[model samples]
Target: MTPPTLMSMMIAGGLIGLGLALLVIWFTPAQPDLNDAVKRLSNTSPHRPDAEASTVNGKERLGIWAMRTLPVGLWAKTPTRELALLRIPLARFYGDKLTYAALGFVIPIGLATFLSLLGLGLPFAMPVIACIALAVVMFFLPNYNAIDDAKKARIEFNRALGAYIDLVALERTNGSGVRQAMETAAGIGDSWVFNRLAEELNRSRWSGLPPWDALHALATELGLPDLDDFADIMRLSGEEGTATYATLRARSAAMRTAMLNDELTEANAIGERMSIPGSLLGVIFMAILLTPSLLRMIPG
Candidate 1:
């Protein structure tokens, strides 16, 4: 057999194997064990829907399979934390990464194969290298997106939290207890962040835990150190019999100022970035305008 024929057969076999694997995965029922079902039922939070768990599609199933089969312990841990902060489930996060990586691998290889079939005569190693490089990059793309999303979510949550602190302080000034003030403030807002607070507070009420404890637990789970600090302040008010109204108000004000400073810093950075493109355009324009004059002076 010719070298080209052997290579073609091998590629064909690989494609067939991949297709069969996908088909098998698609047709297979993912039976939830008793433990998984119980865990799913018990883990429902008011702020996030249970429907997210039920909405897994075939591609996601494939990704889940990949995640289960691969020994990606170190790689999965960091992204899992980031995804949790973004309120994305671990299964879905893994699925997204796997899907991106698959696309990255398939696209370059397919393109190279098409070019080869069209007689482009490219070297074999180039496509293999490109496929690996693209796959690695695409695999990490979801992690980057999750990090950016988590950062934005934290910023928004902090802003809402500041407002919540102010509300709680106002309620406290009106003679409400710490818990009552937190519940009242949380109930006043329709935002997701506020809803999350209300959910945690309600859970604390149900579980016989203190509101501060619930907030601390949530902060720990979501990697929000600011929430932990707020929890500490509440703890101090409850345990030390301190007047917390002024403290809450001051904290709210400080948070707002910090947020404003961050916004201004980001705005200035964006303005600086905008100047770079403007400068590049100016240079390009100058070059275009000068090119003809320079050519004229070339003594042609």
Candidate 2:
């Protein structure tokens, strides 16, 4: 067999093994342990791991241990900034990467063993290469996930910030101080974005730092330049005694317009992409209808 064909078979076998593993995990029920029994007797609930199985949890623990033993630089290329935006712990991220890598490494080995049992021998190089390639691919899954999640989160946060700017402007127009306006505006909204704003403002209040500084720091950490500009506006309002009601309202309106334009652009691009398949189908249909007529015209 060709190298490409052998590699395809190995990859397919690994995928099949992964599917079987998932099915087994899905159908298997957790057995009660002595600790669970004692907890039930005492009317106290036993804590469950968020992972689907204790074995998976054990794998995560192994991942953690391996990460601690391995060089931190080994995982230095990960999405640390995006992870900060998403508030994922470094250890947990590393653990997830390791768990995925372990699965990728083991699946091919298991497939090789199964093939051997059936008297079909694969070259040692095939499974080895497949294992390494898949492991590398799996290890980066969490990085991609963090980037995508942070991207969506930033969009939501920016949408909320436009309203937040308007709310703060309204509060300022009511004769509230800069700090009071920020706190009151943050309290008015019930979204998680507002909760984050409230938390940061409260932290700044406790730490004796200016609210604008805290906001600026948060913006820098989360890559929200809109929030950073808002912080600068608030800073001017607080330190220089400038009126920001008009400025804040203007900024909010501009942000809303930008967001709307972005949505329209994305929709247009999607429609353009979707037209390709429709155009292809139309061409295929026209060809089918004309093929017999063209053949008859040829006078066979």
Runs of candidate 2 exceeding 4 Å displacement: 1-67, 118-120, 293-300
- For candidate 1, lDDT tens digit of each residue in 168-200? 889878999889989999999999899889988
Candidate with top TM-score is 1
* TM-score of each prediction: 0.86, 0.77
Model 1 poorest ten-residue lDDT run: 41-50
Candidate 1: residue pairs that collide: none
- Cα deviation at 240, candidate 2, in Å, is 0.6
Total colliding residue pairs, candidate 2: 0
| Residue 105 of model 2, lDDT score | 85
Error of 1 at 142 (Å): 1.5
Q: Which prediction has the highest lDDT against the true structure?
A: 2
Give lDDT for model 1: 0.78
